[model samples]
Target: GKTHLASALGYKACQEGIETRFWRVSDLVLELEKAWKENQLERFKKKFNRVQLIILDEMGYVPFNKNGSELLFQLISDWYETKSIIITSNLEFSSWNKVFIDPRLTSALVDRLIHHAHILTFTGESYRLKNALSKIE
Candidate 1:
């Protein structure tokens, strides 16, 4: 369910007047990298820390180098139990080590997440083509 479930969750939280900002993982990393270069990383991290749910969409889709992997690990560890994180990935949990360069970090990350997480594996053909072909009829 990568179809904006986190955005919907965030929207609901916002309706209750809770602040939320949804961003893709790559976008977030890019923005934070930019912030780091501009010496405003604190501002971006603060925004993330304030969110009730930080949904990282499309994890394990793109492999991160060691540094990026370490940065991600730090973020997750920092937010461990302090804030909720929703991660969406097409890859199975067993193959998560493929994404993160370091095995230890991957193990730690998965361990922390699975302890308080609910895994929901989605099954079906791609909905994109299904919806598009239906419109042609």
Candidate 2:
């Protein structure tokens, strides 16, 4: 459901000719790790300099390794204040350290994300689950 909402926003931004990228947290960190190994991390990050928005989906679904966590923090920090980001995460902020490993990094990441953000909390049965059960019934 969160992914669906973010996708709709991304679609609208694209319709308005805004440059946008949609990346799953796991996939993005893996790509960053690859870029780091290839010694092209800067080049890879630079590609986002012109993009207006980035939508990071399913952030807490996979925990990040040290390299992945650090790389993801760097990637997000790069766009802090300059570009727009929409992150969809099921984990509460208090539980984010479980995914990030480093408490300090997790704190910093949450701080960056929450500042100037319009917080939206979804509370209910998942739409997908509700629909599936209704169909079966």
Candidate 3:
């Protein structure tokens, strides 16, 4: 539902003709890794040059390799203060290091991401869990 709501915002931006990009965090990292291995990282990174907003979903859902961490750091740094980014993460900021391969990179990336960023934290029992319990009761 969170993702759906975020997606609606992205869709509404698209309706207004904003150049937007939506990506799953893991898949985005995989693509970056692929671009690096193919020696086309610059070209791949430039693909976002015309985009105004980027929605990165499901962060912390999987672990990132060193290269993925580096690539993501570089990308986020490039977008810092220049573009809009919305990230949905399952892990708290304090535990981001668990998903990233390098501690220093994680710190730098988190700093860049949180600069002038609006954070909305999800809390309490999961809706699915509540519904399931009610069904059995």
The clash count of every prediction, one per candidate, is: 0, 0, 0
Error of 2 at 67 (Å): 0.9
Please identify which of the two predictions, 1 or 3, would achieve the higher TM-score against the true structure.
Answer: 3
Clash pairs, model 3 backbone: none
lDDT of 2: 0.94
The candidate 3 region of ten consecutive residues with least summed lDDT is: 1-10
**lDDT by residue (tens digit), candidate 2, 79-128:** 98999999999988899999999999999999999997987899999988
> What are the models' TM-scores?
0.83, 0.94, 0.91
Alpha carbon deviation, residue 89, candidate 1 (Å): 1.1
The deviation in Å at residue 98 for candidate 3 is 0.5
Considering only N, C-alpha and C atoms within 3 Å, which residue pairs clash in candidate 1? none
For each of the candidates, the C-alpha root-mean-square deviation to the true structure, in angstroms, is 2.4, 1.3, 1.6
- Count of clashes in candidate 1: 0
> Quick one: ranking by lDDT, best first?
2, 3, 1
Better of 1 and 2 by TM-score: 2
Model 2: CA > 4 A from native:
134-137
What tens-digit string does per-residue lDDT give for candidate 1 at 6-27? 6788778889977566667766
